[model samples]
Target: MTKDTTILLIGHGSRGREGNKETINFAAQWRERHPEWRIEVCFIEHAEVLLDEGLDRAARNAKKVLAIPFILNAAGHVKMELPHALAEARQRHPEVEFLVTRHLGMGREILAVLQGQLDQQIKAMSVPDPMTTGVILLGRGSSDAGANGELAKMARWIFEDNDHELVDLAFTGVTWPRLETVVQRQVKLGMMQIAIVPVYLFTGVLIERIKEQVARLQNQYPQVSFALGTHFGFDKGIFDLLDSKVNGDIEEGGMLECDGCKYREAAEEEHLHDHSHTAIGGGGCAHGHDHQHEHGHSHAHGCSHKHD
Candidate 1:
């Protein structure tokens, strides 16, 4: 096994083109910070550059590779699809080492992002009602009962753990007290205005559908007011947070270079001759090709990320 290090940032495919855009953009930024590292972006489906292909591309002569899922929940894809794929990839490439980092689950920093959106939405409203202001913690619903249950538990932690002596909280889907139901109860309890903090990293069908749903609920209950919160975008702090996970996994794996954690500039001349990026499964696909209409590139074997 060559000592080469490779990282694969995997995300579930979305019909909404923007979701792909964000995942790709995030990959681009991460690459910029660690230009020396071999990085690539791939999807589960819908997108042409799927996970298997991405893994195949990044496995060339590289001794260690890290496959990190850029998912918010650990329920469905993370627990099932992701691991199975990684296992298969490892079996096919017995010489190369491949592993997965944890999904970006409920964390304090993520809550900080949510709270930030909520605060921004509330500020935009500028209403006089402080106690009457409420928050609807919106999340992409999952089929896994445990994951759904965890959201409620997360909301409880957020509302109570944060020490915010203001506003009421509720979950929008699955578990008990769905979005509309939460809205109804919160309204009955004297909170009239509400803001939705979508527990997603990017905006797309989920965001649009959520806004439409909230709008309908507002119209049905003329007594209540509502507005959608913000989406996560171009935050420098997020890079640092993700960086921590990368580093942690590397240290845990006991590699000479914690392939997951720190970012380093690739010695261009040194890696140019390395097969680590292309030595995995099959003949290389023509990656970095103009794949999408907007981005116009596949960003294969190249997972460069930047601040812009």
Candidate 2:
């Protein structure tokens, strides 16, 4: 086992089989590219391959491990839970250096990926021309108010900046403007054709459910033509986007020197969900990490720590 030889991709697990498979698929893609690099996939909960289990299997032959979370946002798991688990792995395999990479957020390339998916969906529907039609960005909303707010903000910036006719950010669960409500809103806005772009990194039951919800709305508003978009799964562009996040600055030992990471400050204002007292490695972004959230619930904005 040599240094920096193994990679472990981590995902927030779900009870749905396909939700978990997306992470496994990502691992498979990484393995395909870096066959020599030992790779394993793990989950945060609701299934097997817990971080420790993956670490245990890779520890014997791998001197270095990078626990790259497949989650889309930086929340408690990436900030707290997984790091705690990584800390344990570090102690047990003292010789093996460990790195826990940041989750995906605010990447320009991702925006491109999403825009491309929307474009493709428009083309597939053969709806005369898509540039004139409206598009709605949908997602599995989160309980983290900050995270939910961030997505809505991002959606607004994207919509306004791109000159799209109408782009409403809606959620599938625990948030307002659910598919039906948003559909009605779009109807009121005089959008005859709409595309429901699931703002997710992978396909799963949530997308299916959202589609079902859309179907019921279609019955009510048959004049409103809707198209379901694809998730950003295992795409080369996505991999490149993740690769860009890894920079020369990642210390060899996988530890930050202090509390003030430059990226955190930029992200602090982005999430609208409260993190009043939450600590990432013992430092507050803006609101601390103590913002309260009940399981599978949310008041606003969305983040990745929640499983799809």
Candidate 3:
């Protein structure tokens, strides 16, 4: 890639204007924050600016364009579609160098953002001790077991490091231990207060769904109080994470290390569950994307276990 590189941030477009606006604004903030680098934003679908248009804009003065998928995980779009789009762009502009950066996956910065949100929510509860509080991490579940497994692992890390009594992992859709089951399990475990932290980027339908589910749970268990934490938005920490990526500080080689992936053959034989996949990718905005990777397991094993 050339030094005169324009960072093209690709967002999964949304039907709602607010979603689109937020996505565009994130890129705008990045540009203002890092004035030295030339940045442009575009969407895969349901947006004013498309990928091709963003590439054209980048080609004006930039010798190379670094197309970064501003997504949370390495879902379908990152694995296949984005690459396909970049491949097409390369064909169009043969002279201009086109490179694809790694998607926003498991990282220290992301963990920091989650931890910050969790701590803020826990403080608001005014509970006598965090040891009595149970945490329910809600994820946008994917058919790809690998994606679901990643979220489960993060939940374990959170539980182990924090003083919370128990940390449970659950998904809003497509996988096991749905929101209700996880919440009920915590209640059964005699947790007085449960903190529901949504592992999402940006406000969207899934976040709303989580709120609705929390409300239902509150109604069901009036005695047990529930607190729904904020989603990961265009925070400064997130910007710092992206900045590191743009500066070539992120290592992408081990981005998808599926050593014991159930979907793939491993040295240790582990029994895997049969999961039904809908399509390559679907939905726009938030955690909606293609789940083309090898999904490992339901992540049910990690739930309800206290990590000391």
Candidate 4:
């Protein structure tokens, strides 16, 4: 609602040119929709406009800058690097106010996007029967086991909601059962068709990798049909989520169901430290305390994300 505010949508930059261009295109679309506020795009890495440059651009004439982390979740970038970067940027430009919106956490909206994409793939196919079909929810893997397990949770939810006979999870890199192996095994298990639904925000090198694997598998076994689902691009729901965050509707907190999270074991191994040792910044915790551990303090508002 503020007229002098600028919206800085920060993306996880991709090495691929197409990925960067796609982000620019999405920014253009957003600008068209909301002509009042000045909208800009920047990447954390592998792009022309880096975070500092973006801050410089956004603070040119604006009194307030609303920086939305256009990320899937609170991965390493969101948790540690992003906050550190913002802190520096704020120091550099003391005149301009910088506010970071929450990362894109898991919810019914994201599930709706996935389901919509899968539905489109199913409607396009001749045999859309769930009894003989399978779905693979592909994710960009992470070293954090809890983050990796989020994909497993999504797979379970998709299987429960949809009629898919089998819903499996696989990762493209870092950690996991590789996507190629899972697809091949599913074909061998007598799945007549399989849909690879990418749990990604946009097209990157990983999207290309998914396409390559799907093509290789399709050629290897022509009997088992393969279809590629869409990624979460500039969907209306994603826009709504970002808008909600900018409006301060969503609070900071952990988004994943972490009761059985492997990260919990890692977190529990350490003992809490004294609040007197709170670091320079807010310490990445909502509780206002700090500990000098390998993994930083937890925030109730942070979300989990895979390696970008």
TM-score winner among the candidates?
4
lDDT of each prediction vs. the true structure? 0.63, 0.65, 0.69, 0.71
The pairs that clash in candidate 3 are 76-290, 144-295, 145-295, 145-296, 146-295, 146-296, 281-290
Query: Each model's TM-score?
Result: 0.73, 0.78, 0.78, 0.79
User: What stretches of model 3 exceed 4 Å from their correct place?
Assistant: 1-3, 250-308
lDDT of 3 by residue, 1-308 (tens): 24588888888777768777888778888778877788888887788888778778877777787777787765544444455456567788888877666677766777788888888887788854776688988887776655677788788889878888889998888778898998888888888889888987777767777788889889999998788986676878888877777778433432222211222222112322222222223311112223233443333432121111
Q: Candidate 4 — which pairs collide?
A: 74-303, 252-301, 253-300, 253-301, 253-302, 254-300
Give me candidate 2's TM-score against the actual structure: 0.78
For candidate 4, report its TM-score. 0.79
- Give the range where candidate 1 is weakest over 10 consecutive residues by summed lDDT: 270-279
What is candidate 2's CA lDDT for residue 154?
Answer: 65
Tens digits of per-residue lDDT for model 2 on 1-308? 33456767777787778878887887777667656657777888866778788777767777777667777755555554565567678889999877756566545676777778877877777854444567787877765565666577667766866656778888888767787787787788778788878887766777778767877887888887778876776768777765554433254457422123332332344442232223335333333333333443222322223211
How far in Å is the alpha carbon of 240 misplaced in model 1? 1.9
lDDT of 1 at 49: 89
Identify the candidate with maximal lDDT. Answer: 4
Output the worst ten-in-a-row residue range by lDDT, candidate 3.
Answer: 279-288
